[model samples]
Target: MTQPSEGPAATGVPTCYRHPDRETWIRCQRCDKPICPDCMRDAAVGFQCPDCVREASKGSRQNRALYGGERSADPRLTSYVLIGINALVWLAIAATGGTKSRLADLLALRANGLCSPGDGYLYDIERRVCESTGSTFLPAVDDGAWWQLVTSVFTHVEIWHVAMNMFALFIFGPALEGIIGRARFLAVYLVSGLASSVLVLFLSSQYGSTVGASGALFGLLGALLVAARKARLNSQWLMQNLAIGVVITVVGWRMISWQGHLGGFLGGVVAAALIAYAPKEHRPLVQWGGLALVTLVLLGLTALRVSTLA
Candidate 1:
């Protein structure tokens, strides 16, 4: 049998390279392959095929945030998640019991054991002394409730307390996430909270309990200040916020854990500095190493406090 003639119309009308059944006169500007509308991607000069678009993307450097983190598609997502967690914990505490909730008792950070004197009041005392007096002893961080260090960050009892913290997180969380990206933002938050707990462990009453996200929020404030300074951006708004925080901490010193706030702020400053000033040649290594070092230092402080309390 004679073979078909090889010419312009040798294969009949051209079809899409991806979908051979569909006939198309359009072709990719880059690869010159026949492409249908479905397979066509907008290019600088003309339409390009999906394969060419993907291949071009592979060779291009990824866009990163100001602090050398992957740009988040939705910077607000992490904040939303954190808010939801806090809300859920608060609801759980409320359902169990408001300020006197057992859940709150379990979650709040206390450096040492507490004893109930049968009058709905807690007093700091040794477990043996409490037991000898037929009083109820509540375990604390020194008593092996170590999880409180982190849990207290998410636990809150008073309506105003949780509302204020969540509001702060809502205001500042997304902006920080957008600047540093999700992972680094979360790192700053948790590390700041932990530092706050560490300070409470040492500076606050061993018998007194502490809980709330203020430490982490204070941390975000500090991080924002450092980040703005490093990026050479205007930071008047940040300074105002910091001023407000300082006023609140000072005014509420009797009722609030000022030590926690101080610890968190310092932690955030150090964390953001590490992230923003990391060497570009080895940015990830240096940034992560610095954060890890800070965490270890906080943990070491916590251990030392625990030893002293023990």
Candidate 2:
């Protein structure tokens, strides 16, 4: 029997390798079985069987079942509350301090805001740069405060600044948390937030400040993008909504760092993708593939930045 192309071929007698009589219509790349499109899964750039997808989808539930700890916030409960706190912090800051720059300012940034020029010379202002050391790095032209990396995500400059961001996080956090578990979720959250800051830091080490949790939140969204695919859920709706958000953010807004958003998101998605979602007989090279790519990006960014300064 012939099979339809697993990917996209006009007309072919797709044959099922498993059942020779059955047309290998849709090929599952993982198991190499010919399944209908319904049973086909797009994963890591190839098609996988339904069983593979189901197994991948089970990681989150399995982890949750095995270990349930901490009464800290239900993750769901804290989702909205966390968002509220971020917004409130931003509002309080703005109300009292007036408009500030991005959240990175406290961590170790010294920029005025959102890649704002005139903050200071890149290396010239060590104090302005966000540092990995210390509690929150205060944005100064001389040296960056470090604690701010963690704290930056929580503070905002205005009321609406973090409000919408928190809303997005509140909505997406639970689904992501369910997939990765609290520990993994928080890890992604913090790590991605810092990753975003690192991206911003690479961009301009001057007096620019960053605020809001959108970068970290975007990381969750990024993870969900892959999770949705792995779980065999319809991603069209999500893809479109997120696309709109990207347009609004990248194309239509100022004071927004698409780099941070993209970097953090890539970090989170890659982090989630690192371990395996689908059942595999061996550790996937694709796991290392993402790491290599991110490392290259980070290294390239760091180099470009240094060269520019020099």
Candidate 3:
């Protein structure tokens, strides 16, 4: 095996070679060598000098820190915030009657006096393709209303739907976000939501106005799985959580859209892996590439939806 490329400059030490009377060493707590940080072995708490290597015993509290100054993980707080946002949106939908024209009438989109308003995130399959009734809520396929993807996440038909979605989001999202920091976590959440929607719109057989944060919630789970792996974590706990998701998904298939869940899960996984694990230099490329891929997929799904209608 090739040795590290340490030049002669590293062989000599500014550290006192032989401290007779004037010099002493704090020594690295680990290796015990009198090394400055430049030569210090990696440790969780403080530098480890070379001589202490054989004697050092370590505890694990060092590696798993998530927030400020060695604070405990805060996935719980993250979950509650997500639940609150989704719950607010769910209440908005509930205020309106869960009907095609009613939602359209409320959201303010009308076509040929056929547009219904209120807050249904999607037009059902029959409405999406067989009819051209307008929607105040569902953005036009070609319009620049990118907010649709984001807002769509908040639109759920019933209390239990949003509640379940928010519950899962509360569990997984905070954990994942805590690992990646607020900004990265936000990216994972939003992009995964869009990815999930695009995937459903592309492959789903049913098309009734659909909306929920479940896609983002699934994305958080995916990100948590990937991040755990990268962090060299023992993922048994997270794996069990994922199993719960799988069970809930299969059992609830008639009520929740599996296509959206799957799409969102996959999107979250890809986005998290790409963002969380990429080298610093490559992060920008990964982010832009994700945006481009999701945008293209969204466009393609729209085309397919329109074609089916025609």
Candidate 4:
């Protein structure tokens, strides 16, 4: 006659807690419960049960970037900041009034003079009136108001315009920022914006003034294309959407600044190239230097354009 021991028997092997039918000599290091091969998971020191592994996973730390590009604590910060700036500017514009307001005149980008109302009969700053009828008319770039090139990137004409551009930025900004990081993303944006404005100044007709973040938005699109390619991501959808945008722009080329879009796209491609190709060890320095070189080239082009006006 055999007597059942109160504790586990010392003769027979222990069965898995999960699987009573299977016998195993293994035990969970943390819980000391018998675990079979099916229930076993190798740990740093010893085997752990599925439940214990799951619990440990909860306690363990895992760091991942927002868009799966880099390890960042805050991935959406830059995108939200940009959106906030644009929204605040739009709100300020709404509070002051539309084109008629003096604030709008000051903030808006004019292709003429930089002064207040009635600066010139041909060009009025307050009114934003530019008369291309006379030879005395000079582009705003030649007026020593180079700040317009930068300011104009943030300005928008209509509500729909700002809304559309901001919506695009909202969708694309975070992902791009996560992949390229805040600094490089910002450089791509600003450099592309400046390039678009410069193109408008040089290539487009100077009869009217241009304003909007479309240039920068276009830059983001171009940069995304390049960055996605570098990361081996699927960009077919992006390419399709971009093709549609191009079609729309071409359809409304008369009303929209296609030149700005073209320039921004090109600039973004160049900036993304620099950022993507830089040496990993000196990425920050190389990226910054590349941005600076791009800026210098743009500035030189602007100088050449201004010289023509002079």
Candidate 5:
């Protein structure tokens, strides 16, 4: 018995939209376009051509999973906003001549110091040039500079410091935002930053102020580790980079604040744990509760430190 030939020319049937040389009886469910086996994609209802499938995907809603969530918001929106804020702050500082600028004095994080312009630290008031040690001589609790705990996260004394910290944030922020969503990620970043400042207030004896987003960026890394673990995702590379960062931080402890890094890392871990391990049924409430608890702890620490100063 002779088998019937399936060639397009032999059958004289409709050719595929993508490949005129191939004939197919199957058509896309949406567009009704003839498509070859290679162009066919399995859809919920029926087979679809590559073009129809792509178009459908663009219109379809994404589903939530066990690891992350529905991701209804733009994943990178938070990261871009954060980067923009940091960049704007850095540019403003640069325009004002950095440490000597009045803006810097107002924005920079001083744990327990209170120095202003013309207090002998502002050697060049007109040019906004001040001594690097200007922050060391200021009064702390006596002057009511408690807001430094929060403001410090946005302040950076020099170009290099801001650049380095922002670079780290740029690298890690988007990935984290994708994993935990905007609100949770923002909460982790801010709380960790505050935690870092609080640690500085307690641990450092010098009156010098510390500023930068290093603590917050480190907190993101810590959160990444925890979330990846909860999702059973491979985090070996993150671990390696974290170890390297720790070593670099230790070697440069003179220039960097170890206390800030430690506090931020711990805070990120705790915050992420609360978010990642939350029961699916009451995740939002549990996450909010965790955030509240963390905030209370940080506030308690800050109050305790201020009292000591008093």
Candidate 6:
């Protein structure tokens, strides 16, 4: 053989740095190191070695929203999922019996039991008396119907009711999700719904039943308002809409569950404030911690209410 040249390529094919036994003609675009097919990772211009790829990833900053939330790839995804769930539930209720659906009875939030005296209407009555009258008895939160607190948020008896709430969700949900990210947006919705239920347990008549996504939608509205304020955008339109909602709630108090609306609004405000104003140095900690505290407070209030009802 001829005398060995100064360069390895002059004598033989270059070997991969990672796998010395494997020969390769390709060099890493980033580090210019010989790389075999197994060691190659595609990059903007050409293939890179694993080491170079890892180093580049480390140096790259992750994309985040203004409120310290991860930027969403599809902001409408979460809202669409929520809407789909509500729609499915609504269809189930309709297929069962609309207003008189047993599904509704099982899902609607009621603080105390009610008696249905074979008239398709419920009345507050003692279990003993209801049984004596041969009427059907329905249990409530006080009687271990705790699931109703969440189920009711997805329940609706009227087409118009579901339509209006879903329309509102479609309008506001994606916007807020884009700003705060999907996970935070979902948390705001659920916590707000729970808060609304708790307030309903305390404020509504024990005999009355409540249902609908109004609470969660109101929560989104509240969150959107806070986000707008934080972004220094004009919120006059939001304020006007809120005022209109307040008027509607006041006027329709006899028919609507104002307790749910107010509770959800308040919950959303607190949750959004915590998320939007969290310290940049410890954003996730402060945001999640504040939400947890709010949840605990709501639970404590629920426990207190349960004690009274029990």
Q: Point to the candidate with the largest lDDT.
A: 1
Scored by CA lDDT, what does every candidate get? 0.90, 0.60, 0.60, 0.76, 0.77, 0.87
Model 3, backbone clash pairs (residues 3+ apart or across chains), number = 31
Cα lDDT of model 5 by residue, 147-250, tens digit = 76777788876778878887788788888888887778898999899888888878875467688888888899999999899889999989997998899899
Clashes of 4: 0
Where does model 5 exceed 4 Å of error?
Answer: 1-61, 65-73, 115-142
Misplaced by over 4 Å in model 2 are 1-75, 100-108, 111-142, 275-310
Between prediction 2 and prediction 4, the one with superior TM-score is 4
lDDT of 1 by residue, 208-275 (tens): 99999999999999999999999999999999999999999999999999999999999899899999
| List of clashing residue pairs for candidate 5 | 112-140, 113-138, 114-138, 114-139
Per-model TM-score on C-alpha atoms: 0.85, 0.57, 0.60, 0.70, 0.72, 0.81
| Residue-by-residue lDDT tens digits, candidate 4, 1-310 | 2223245434577987876666679999999999978788999998999999988765344532222224445757877788787777777777777654445555544444533324333434332343433223333656777887887788765789888898889888877887876767788899999999889888876555777888888899999999889889999987986897799899999989998999999999999888887876887678788889999999999888877766
Error of 2 at 145 (Å): 1.4
Segments of candidate 3 deviating more than 4 angstroms: 1-81, 98-147, 284-310
Q: Of the candidates numbered 3 and 6, which has the greater lDDT value? A: 6
> For residue 144, what is the lDDT in candidate 6?
81
Q: Cα-based RMSD of the predictions, in order?
A: 5.4, 16.4, 11.1, 9.2, 8.4, 6.1
- Give the per-residue lDDT of model 3 (tens digit) for 134-169: 444334332333455566776766666767777677
Ranking by TM-score: 1, 6, 5, 4, 3, 2
Whole-model lDDT, model 6: 0.87
Cα lDDT tens digits for candidate 6, 1-310: 2223334433477987876666689999978999978888999999999998887765354556668767788989998998898898999999998987888889999989989887867788878899898987887888788888899999888989999898888888898998898889999999899989999999999888999999888888899899899989888888887888889999998999999999999899989999999988999999999999999898888878889976
Per-residue lDDT value at 74 in model 1: 94
Pairwise TM-score winner, candidates 3 and 6: 6
